[model samples]
Target: MGDNIHLDYKYLSSLFSSVESITFEQYIINQKIEHAKELMVYDEFSLSEIAFKMNYRSVA
Candidate 1:
């Protein structure tokens, strides 16, 4: 999906026009955290593992 989509900053800014209080990257991080919460419900995965799967630089 990343290869197919060119995520330009200006385009992302326009895409998240309704979230005026937050930057696009922050919005994405929030979304990722939400998804991580959903994934966390599955007990087979640890938070550190999920963080890595979500491409976080540090699990802390």
Candidate 2:
């Protein structure tokens, strides 16, 4: 079951790599920030916990 839901990292890598004119790193950062904002609205977890879950070193 878990195996059926997995990230196609290779495909994503190829797609991101082909975007020659895009700021791909910034795109990823923006997406993460948006997700954090959404989670903050829910108020389920503390900011520090959310930042840790998102792999941040600290809740800046």
Candidate 3:
């Protein structure tokens, strides 16, 4: 994400945390979980498939 915006990663993370009050990694996980919930509503993929698509280490 920083590369796309042409900022150093450390700087970007600092800025993000300052503005959002959450670390960038945690923000990403929240987004992925929200997207997974949306996908579940659509019912197009199984739980394991959603976990895999979200890069989770396990379905649990």
Instruction: Report the CA-based lDDT of candidate 1 relative to the real structure.
Output: 0.80
Best-performing candidate as measured by TM-score = 3
lDDT of each: 0.80, 0.79, 0.93
TM-score of each: 0.60, 0.64, 0.80
Q: Decide which is better by TM-score, 1 or 2.
A: 2
**Number of clashing pairs per prediction, in order:** 0, 0, 0
Cα lDDT of model 3 by residue, 1-60, tens digit: 778779999999999999999999999889998999998999999999999999998989
Residue 28 in candidate 1, Cα distance off native in Å: 0.3
Tens digits of per-residue lDDT, candidate 1, 1-60, equal 234577876766776766677877788889999999888987678888898989998878
List the candidate 2 regions with Cα displacement exceeding 4 Å.
1-22
Error of 2 at 42 (Å): 0.3
Indicate whether candidate 1 or candidate 3 has the larger TM-score: 3
Q: Is candidate 2 or candidate 3 better by lDDT?
A: 3
Residue pairs of candidate 2 with colliding backbone atoms: none
| Tens digit of per-residue lDDT, candidate 2, span 1-60 | 124557576665566768854456767888889999988999998999899888889999
